[model samples]
Target: MKTKIIYLLMACIFLVSCQNLNRPSGQMTRVERVVSGQTIEIADRSVAVPLLEPIRLIGIQAPDIRQNPWGQEARIQLEKLTLGQEVLLEFDTQEKDGFDRLLAYVWLGGKLINEYMVKEGLALAKPDFPNTKYMERLTNAQEKARLMGLGIWNPNQPMRQTPGEFRSQNLKQ
Candidate 1:
């Protein structure tokens, strides 16, 4: 009976440890590649074959790569901020989107990369439902960028359409 009890306790402990390991929040990972202005791929080393986990920055949207100068510019800016750097990921209410991409607020060197991108006018504040932990911060950053006439907000050369609109239009073409 004592041996069975010991085994049960050990199993309980193992299960608890597994739960913690599976939690996505507060995970520190290295950026393997920058997919776009608001998305990045991180190396998941937990499995034998390392997989690139794509993470979408919560509360922000960037131009599509085909959106002309803006799209390419956003990608380049995001690359400059996160490519090959270690970043901390903080998960929100909904961890993954329908596309299976992890939805997270990425932090690098104490800066929230999502908010920074909006503030720099490289992206827009786009808060999706159930994942708005930093929505206000991102919106404020975008406002500031607009006021400063930066990037997409430039009075002389503003972006013609939002990233969503651009994508939707492109789909029909």
Candidate 2:
């Protein structure tokens, strides 16, 4: 009876841990370029053979070229994260978005780049998926960076507005 109880408890723990929803066995590949703050084109398209696919780094949104003052900063940081670099790209089970960008987590030197963006306050942890792991940690990092006013959080920086929004707002009457 004692042995059975111990086994049951261990099984329960394993079950709980296994529920983490990230894509298992997602392949690693070499980054070809920093197409955007959250995306990189990869070289090893094993499923499609040399057809470079755009992998969107999961969990964070770097400043966009539009209306986010940190546009340059985001691009710069992302470049630093994976410019012609080799990194592990982990996928979400939901896979590609409607726009066809492959959703993934970019890991470099055992570090998660998506979470790093939030940690460094260069991005926000936009939660579209449930986290079997790392959500709280990501949020805490983003909060700390946000509080410190780093990068995009800097108040004196120029804000980002889209071309449409810019024209509407600043265009002369």
Candidate 3:
């Protein structure tokens, strides 16, 4: 009987630990670090306990840090907008990326940061990802930014590769 009780107690503990593995979908958190224009480290405050997780912005892919002027500009803009700010995170069907980054739609005040980045021409609409909750909105934003010659959209500017293209070539070693 003691062995059975011990096994039952262990099972209960395992269940609880699994629940804590990821934040519940559609929660609010404070941005503690901007990993890039498309990713951030956020601290969940809904629980009595808080934990930090890196969240990749859904539907948009920003320039990589090594992508030169555009990459640096995107990171700077992300920092300016999100560092130390509160954001609401809305998760899609897939909660995490292969890299273990939480995937979310981030809201700063009323603005959607994912769409904002594409709208501002700092990122590209990532259609390849399966979780495409905001793909249409992001694509529209990218089009508008392109027509307006904003950020990386300027025709006179040097051709800037998408983050995916950059990573595919540079990270292929």
Q: Candidate 1, residues 1-173: lDDT per residue as tens digits?
A: 99999999999999999988744458889999998998999988999999999999999989998888889999999999899998999988997998999999999987999999999999999978998878888989999999999999999989999998999999999
Task: Put down candidate 2 lDDT per residue, 1-173, tens digits, no spaces.
Answer: 99999999999989888876443345767888787677788775567567777887776766564445566677778898788887886765667876798888778887888888877767777764742245676778788877887765666763354334554665554
- Looking at model 3, residue 160 earns an lDDT score of 68
Candidate 1 residue pairs that clash = none
The top-ranked prediction according to TM-score is: 1
Off by over 4 Å in 2: 1-25, 47-49, 130-133, 158-173
RMSD of 2: 5.2
Residue-by-residue lDDT tens digits, candidate 3, 1-173: 99999999999999999988644347877889887878889776667897777899988888888887788899899999999987788888787889999889988877888999999989888873678777888899999999999888878784367777889999887
TM, every model: 0.84, 0.71, 0.78
Judge candidate 3 against the unseen true structure and give its global Cα lDDT, from 0 to 1: 0.84
Give the CA lDDT, 0 to 100, for residue 150 in model 2. 70
Candidate whose lDDT is highest: 1
**Model 1 CA deviation exceeding 4 Å by range:** 1-25
C-alpha local distance difference test of each model: 0.91, 0.71, 0.84
Note each model's CA RMSD in angstroms.
10.4, 5.2, 13.3
Q: After superposition, how far is residue 59 of candidate 3 from its true place, in Å?
A: 0.4
